[model samples]
Target chain A: MTVAVADVPAVPPDLLTVAHLSMRFGGLLAVDDLSFVARAGQITALIGPNGAGKTTVFNCITGFYRPTAGHIALERGDRSFDLDQLSGHRIARDAGVARTFQNIRLFPRMTVLENLLVAQHAKLMRASAFSLAGLLGLKGFREAEARAMSLAEDWLTRLGLVHVADRECGTLAYGIQRKIEIARAMCTEPCLLCLDEPAAGLNPRETAELSRLITSIRGEFGIGVLLIEHDMGLVMGISDRIVVLDHGACIAEGKPAEIRNNPAVIRAYLGEEDPRAGPGSTDAPGAGDGA
Target chain B: MALARAAPTVSSGVLRAAFGEALVAAGIAFMLALPLAGLRLPINPMDSVIFRPWWVVVAVATVFLGRLGLALWRARVAPSRRNGVPLLDRALAYILPWRRGIFVAFVLLVAILPLMPFADRRVIDLGAVVLIYVMLGWGLNIVVGLAGLLDLGYVAFYAVGAYSYTLLIIHLDLNFWAALPLAGAFAALFGVLLGFPVLRLRGDYLAIVTLGFGEMIRIILINWSSLTGGSEGITSIPTPTLFGLTFTAVPAPGETAFHQFFGIPFAGVHRIIFLYYLILALALLTHVFSMRIRRLPVGRAWEALREDEIAARALGLNPVMVKLSAFGLGAMFAGFAGAFFATRQGFINPSSFTFIESAIILAIVVLGGMGSQMGVILAALLLVLLPEVARDFAEFRMLLFGGAMVAVMVWRPRGLLAHREPTATLGDLSRGREPAP
Candidate 1:
């Protein structure tokens, strides 16, 4: 039951490092000593069973739920922020960590474009004195507004949401709404993007599009994408590195190929399926993959 | 009810395209048939129109237009992709120099209304008061409508503004104009102070705290007799003047005050007209300011916070700052109205600034439609005017008011004129094809 911290590899000199991150809710330990490094310009996938604490890790990292014990350090070019010490919104605005909810939390009443502009609120505040200076026509105020609008428009075009840019987010289809939510998150131009189940409700085609979108975002935008997806197809396809968690512990970590065949991962997927002679007692296909 | 059903999800464009012409057509036609209906002019309409009512020309026109609008849609238009009208289709889009239209029309209407023989002096005075309420409602709308924060103690700021003006002008011998801005400043400062604590509280908790805050201010106004005159109210407070020409001028023997100035009848009606314009300008200013703010990024942040706090926070918006600004800007308007209220009446008292006043202003914002300046103004007029118009129905007034409010809410839960949040880029909703899921 006691997993030694030293067993994990040394923390990488990456933009974000979570060392010994553990979150417990009363009797239930949601995330137990889960540690991972998110390098810049890469897609990192955290995949696990329904209750495997992938989202719990996201919540802990995003400051929605403060972990019981953890160290989350976020490094910019020169400055570093103690992510664990920051508040939820501060994690977003200050640490440049933006996240989209699993449930697609959008300002449904607001227009699609307004959703994006609002995401750039902090930057806009810096440019405009909370819009008062913008009103007074201060120098650079107009440029900031144009920048915000252009950024919003860019995301809208990228997501193919140009048509519904003025439409209320509530009125869009579930898939489109999800895309808008992601676009809104990107409009913040965060250093790290944490997407909780972005592909959860998407159809197969939509999921494929989402995969391309995530990959392009990392490759083009030069930002780290941390995704918690239930769809193994997406995780297996786009993720450069996969972190597998089982019952709040890191059961496996490597390239997708290595994690796919890890015996511990197989056992984690099918409990009581023997770690020894695993191919014989099969619940479904992929039982032999552990070989 | 049937008409409401037909236009259940009607957008602002549909209403504008169909409502104005329909209202005009219906108004004329209904007016012609009034004699046959035997409803008289029905000087002031009543809620009894709901049950015992014989209708009027205007009423019939509204019904007829509503029906025609529904029929036109059912016959001519096929189901399309667009959800709402584009901004280009707006009326202001059609006209040149549209900003001046409302202002010019307002000035003309105010100037001409008093000149009409049928326009009662009392009615003009009532209109002036309604304008003040419109100003207050627009101010409150910024807080409750745009920000989606329910403020029940808004009258506290109003009281603060009024007292600041009254006490400062009287005790310190400051000019009415000078105290006015200072009153607004003090009230706005207090708004920020109030915003700091109550910003964390949303919905009913925020309401209760504001209500408490309002009551605290009122209790102070009453108990602080040495300064406030303690319910006796500082009377004989000097009314505002225009270039040394006071509303009241001592008549030479048989000559009236107006005679001394311009050889006209001195009925004190000119003062009411001046007050009307003063408040009209204030209300217009409030409407313009709110409209401008609602289009800005901070304004969008307020709305985002209103809709989803979690999402707003995720967007990197500081909710505390947004909420406080809502309170600050909203209270500043209320403060402006409060200063005007004190100067207009030349009297200050605790009872005049009550929780009920706050409720009525809030009610106007709710009934008119939150986030709609025009809707707020219309609601203010309806709520304020209807009560005054129903002086004959005094015993049943409250019942009728409550019933009408309930009925309106039932018919339009969002408000009479719900406005969509403005976006930076207008989307073509028709092109939003929903892929089969």
Candidate 2:
């Protein structure tokens, strides 16, 4: 199912464009001259070994870290936001970029439904007139609250979490928690979804389900997905495009088949082995794929 | 005969362990009681120290017996753990199911207490004081309980409120009704002021800064003698009126006495009952506002921030604004209670706004369970009434209080009521298909 390079231009336009991104942590150049583009309505997987600056790229894109030198442009409608220039929360609030952490960062004590509702806080807050209307239980605020609840319910039902919707996030299993995190990010109604290591701790069956969920999210929401994953099987299975990174630089970029056969990508994963050794190596990639 | 022999072996092992544990506890108790109870220094240096060996003996004996009983109890309950739940927890489980009913009953009881035949002057006064603490606890619950900000100097805002009211009335000739909201606004302003510097701080560091701020306010009140009257305090501050009708036995010139306006016989109890109702109204307003806001977006944001600040930020919540609002609103309630405090006492002093008062209010919020309104009320009742009830133990009143607090912590470290009801539910709960948990 590999497509020719000439077919790329006919695909959707870029939703996120990262140009010459470099992040320096004192003596260590965590991300050096990294560049990639995630197109709208496409799944772009950033795959690399551990400490290959994949998450650094994510942090820069999500405004968690201000890159030492870079231009991160997020296109939405006619306006383009310079993400590196924005603060951590404004990136999500103004630029419509939502992300999940590598480690699940759900509101553990809060119920699953409340976690989703909290993500819609900004919208509901305005509709409630900062709580004056909510305090009064006015019709406008009630309608707004009902709307938010339905949105939360929609996501809960879609994720097959209706049964545990009332359960606290902390008490749920790891795979469920991961799915809830994605649902929570979707509640923000972002134009681009950034998932960091969504398949990190999932079993093969769970990873397969996650891959399907991510695919459906992109298809249904019509939003770009920027994924940072080490699960090569999941990535190779679902990614529309794959950008392979090593030593904070882009080693290769193409479709899954191209990346699978790319010699540099193999060396980056298998580490200095002969290129002809191929995918038959019994040894796991040093990237901690958890596969 | 064989069964009896096995029983003795098991009983002897248990007895030996219990005895050893009791001995250790008694030794520690002896050391602790040595300076506190065994010996006392003479007032005059020339006099020899007095010894109280019997006091130490009593302490050691009590410790030994207490430890022995505890060990035996553990030994007996360890095998059948089903019965090992604390008595208080068992009672709580039964009572918690009827929490809403209990709250209604509690409110109704307090409402009719002043009218009850058994209610005397002292009882009504105690009720007023408890209400003040209740209001303060609810206010601090927003900051410490909901927002997860430890504000050790909350009394600073209370002081600001008290001083704002007194100074407004004295200097500007303003009445209580007029000064009430203004006092709250001033305290909120101070809350925002304190919040600005501590926005970057969290946990223990935030607590230390707030503690300093509280002391700083008190010190400023003291040293600014020209305004606050130094440590001497301001006296004869005007009390609140029933819409211009003063609660006085004799009408002063143009003033109408409360009894005279109402055509009732003059009685001093009228004033006490009136003050009780005034504080009650203010506290009820605080409670209603808190209860309503708990389900609001801002309130959920506060809880979210408490649960995880980073997650809240990712959701586009401005931590600075949410925190400031918590501090401001919490301090505003403290301000209202402070104004009531000033009017109730008919005097204003820095000593009235002490660290101990702040500690007591914080304790009420924590012991009640953070962010639990009913918990605060129950905790306030326990804390305020316990000390008064144990007055017979005068010197040991605080000791009793400390012991009670320790016992509660041991049984329910998360507070008396830590369970949180979700702000909203979906599907089955909303549609009534399932009972609300």
Candidate 3:
């Protein structure tokens, strides 16, 4: 089911284009002159060591942070949204961008089903006529509620969380909570899904399963997947393209095989004195060279 | 280590620890009661303090014995009980299973209480008062419990409702029924007004701002003498009528008295009973509305915002609108209760709606268990009736109330009924599968 990198069109349509993005927190420039492109139906992995401004890029793309200087554009057919100009919520609501946090952010007291339904709030809220129809249990609202419920059930079953669908999310196992977060984000039906460190605290088997699930989501939904992950095995295995960041700048960007051999990427990761001295050394240029 | 030791030695050690702890408790109690209980101030400051040593002795002994019992229970009975189950938890387990039945029974009892022979005029009036608080508690439950917004100025909306009705009747010549909804609408308006400024605040900050807003409204009522009559609140406020029938001993000319319309002799108790039922119906409306809205999308959004605001915003939910809606709806119910208050008492002043009133209502929501409907009723009854029942111990009534609150907090830190059931279930869907156990 995986498409070879060589099979990709020379100019694939860009779902998200973040150019010259710079985010400064007071004196610290968290992200500096970062630029990247995530094509539709492709898994783009943003990988770097801790504090490499990988999450900062994701934040700017998802409208969580206003970049000091940059353009973050999300193209959906005929329409394009400047994510940097929109508020945090509107970026998700109007622009169709959904995201998951590094730390799990499920509504702990709410049931898993409720958490998923909440992700579909914008649609259900409109159907309920701001709760007037829901209050009266009108046919329109009931049908909408049923549709939302089925969507939640579909995600729960797919994620193997059906057994704990009615349980409070906080009471579930950590691995299950991670899966629920992904399910919740998917329920929003975003054009681009940004997952910040999706496999941070998972076992090898769970990480492998996550890789497969993420690939299937990309293939089945035809949505762009922008992932910030530390698990190198999973990242290199599933990513169609990989973007490497170091100290808030793009160090290298290319196919997974190229990134694996790029001397700058190895030097950024291993802190090697010379590019040729690293384990996976290659006669490649230094940082800030985007392929 | 202690449990493995000899039985006699363990018993002796337990006794010694209990006695030491009780002695310390008695010493602390003596120190506290010295100025308050042992010595009392006479009316005149010139007079010497009147010493009441017996009061001090009684206080110390009560503390001593209570502490001794608690210490012994922990050291001796508690360890063995832990192997099985604690008495309180076991009792709760038994009661929790039949909570729905208990709730229905409680409702039935209250519904038929006024008709009971034992329910005198005083009892009915007290019942009405308790129901008013119950309605207020439930109204605040929406904001404080489900939305997780700490609103200390809920009384502002209540005051708004009361004043709205009273002024509408005075200026516009409106009847009670006509003014009730308007009063609620005015309170909701004020709720939204207050909500706008404090939308960014949460927890303690929100509490402080709301507390200030409540006081601001009360102060306005006190200062704005022209519209609100200042400190001298509007008096001779008209009581509510059943249709065109007034509940008066002698009907005004061209007015039909309630008893005359009913073809029965006039009795003051009839008016009291009517007021009781009126407040009961209003409280039930508040209860049913809160319950229904709990399952709605807006309700879920409130709860979702409460759990995690940032995460909620990220998921495309507007925190501003969600918070405002909660504030508006919560205040609407408070307004309804306020209108009822003004009509029932026939007089309302700034003194009636104070910070303490807000505290009492918040206490009921908390002590009852936040967001739990039945818990609010139980807590309102306990909080309102406990003081009235302890009238004989006028000097110690507040003391008893505070003690009961402390005991409940220590035993049930999450409130009396903290268990929450999800608003929707998977089994409700037509999946043709049994719900997970």
Candidate 4:
């Protein structure tokens, strides 16, 4: 149902281009005319204060919500996905856009391996011929199943979850569950991966492990990563680029060094007036329209 | 050391609590059973009433001793067993090692049961009834256990299958073998039709809608007198033959019945044994087919959907296709069972496919443990055969059944076989391989 809505061909510059993206819940403009680009093979951090529209932007891009108005285009290797036009599941299935929840959402009763195998459901189902061929243990179905298992095992090992592969997911520690969620999303082999607050409840050690995992995921996998993180330390440590948002509109977008020094970005986090608060601010052009 | 120190006070407190509980239990037992146990019912033929006061003391003493023994056992074994597996669980694990062997042996026995010295006609017939329910349970297991869809109207599919066979074989003059698949197809069609509207509903709402659908089909079958024969139902339906040869008392013109064709004597046991084996084969087929499906991708998808629908959707699974496949496949099995039921009885009616049948099938699935094929068989035998054995108690059979069900639930809330394994296991990763179990 979601795939059918992707009728228009759309290709913007870069892996993902959010052009004039706007979202509204009733009167609240959760994301208002926000625009940014995330290049392929880079970790891009979406940072803002507590109520910033970071998660909302992720939700709209993933097609969980019908944006009030916007153009969110994702360009895969040979194809481009008009994310705004695609619905929720098609965005993940067809557009190669995968996302993790703010809270971990692993299939708890299923084993760690099963959780990852389930991520490759579409491909296996296609090869299985509605499971009749699989039931008979046909060659094609067996090969497909073997491929799915290896992919799952690969992701599990990368996330350091292979030891607990046979254990049900719910029994695992919270930090491990988070990694499994990321690994499960990775099993989909998406070009663009969106992670929501992956380090929310981790300790300093686990947070460091998460930062290393995220860095390796980008480096080894060569995929664009859009991360929503509250930990400034992990964000500044791993991000190649940072986009700052306040309320619903973008205040600044640039390299981590430039973003870290920007007066408006500081003011958004500190929530105070400074000598550089006005139009004199580098990226903050009075919040309305810098355009 | 701290645990050891705390153990003394904890043990003393436990003992005091047990003493207090036993005293209260004894008091309650005495008051409750005083009149019931101590007094004779209908009095005697000579007197208005006869009081046996020592009966009350016996009741009180039994409760007192039983409670005290239970308390002491809980204090002693429960504490030590806390850090260790319980004996019941250990026994289950002991059985687990031989589970596959046990299952094979059980199936072998079932196969040769009709030939067994002790196997009477009534016993074989009862076994057939159990097998029918076993088939039904396996079918519903796909929808409810694997797909995680709460479908309470699975019996509707059974009803559809039976009616389809009745209409096709008798009315349309189709062969029983040909009508079998046709019956299953009709049931699958109904499954898909019912599955479409309730695709978006979850949990209790899905259950209620399916329940309504079941009732709706039964009501229609009742009111459509011309088509279904109403409450009177269709009769004299042709039974399934062994390759067009009937197992009959009187041979049809130009037709050589089963016994004559085989050159065996025309004994009723021949028909009964044939029917038993027919159902046994069907049940075994359903079991083997479902277990294989469980290892396949679509089966894994059903499990994923069951665990969490949002997660399944996130995996890019087409929920509609997965859910419908479960419904269609499950209903097909139900259809097969229903056709067999019709053939076995040579009569059909709406009353035979009631909500009670659906409930019993579901109870087998749940009590057997959701998704476990072997659990379904065990549950079917327990639910079906236990009541028959308890028939000596007559009206109390149901009460005994209810008590046993309650006891099993209290013992294992997650069902009998709660252990789960991953759907797929790798031989080895490309690198950094862990040894396979």
TM-score head-to-head 3 vs 4, winner: 3
lDDT of 4 by residue, B327-355 (tens): 99999999999899998998999999899
The pairs that clash in candidate 1 are B26-B61, B30-B57, B31-B57, B81-B430
Stretches of candidate 1 above 4 Å error? A1-13, A273-291, B1-111, B243-245, B250-267, B421-423, B427-437
Off by over 4 Å in 4: A1-12, A273-291, B1-65, B428-437
Q: Is the docking of candidate 4 incorrect, acceptable, medium or high quality?
A: acceptable
How much RMSD separates candidate 2 from the native structure?
Answer: 2.9
As for model 3, its CA RMSD to the true structure in angstroms is 3.4
Candidate 3 lDDT, tens digit per residue, A1-291? 124666766756899999999999999999989999999899999988789999889888877788999899999878999999999889988898999999999999999999999999999999999999999999999999999999998888787778888899999999999999999999998989999999988998999789889999988998999999877777777788999999999989987778877878777777776445544322222222222
Please give, for residues B1-437, the per-residue lDDT of candidate 3 as tens digits: 55547543347767889899999999999998887689988899999999999999999999999999999778866777668855666787788879879977888899999999999999999999999999999999999999999999999999999999999989999999999999999999999999999999999999999999999999999999999999989887898998888999999999999999989999999999989999999998998888889999999999999999988999999989999999999999999999999999888889999999999999999999988887798899899999998888877799889999999899888888776879888888956786433
Residue B331 in model 3: lDDT: 97
- Each candidate: fraction of true contacts kept? 0.70, 0.72, 0.74, 0.69
The whole-model lDDT of each prediction reads 0.79, 0.89, 0.89, 0.85
Q: Residue-wise lDDT of candidate 1 within B145-257, one digit each (tens)?
A: 87889999999999989888888888899877788789888889989999999877999999999999999999999999988889877777777655445677563455345
Note the residue pairs that clash in candidate 3: none
Ten contiguous residues minimizing lDDT sum, candidate 3 chain B = B1-10
Docking quality (DockQ) for each candidate: 0.42, 0.57, 0.61, 0.46
lDDT of 2 by residue, B125-222 (tens): 99999999999999999999889999999999999999999999999999999999999999999999999999989999999999999999999999
Give every candidate's TM-score on chain A. 0.89, 0.93, 0.93, 0.88
User: What's the DockQ of model 1?
Assistant: 0.42
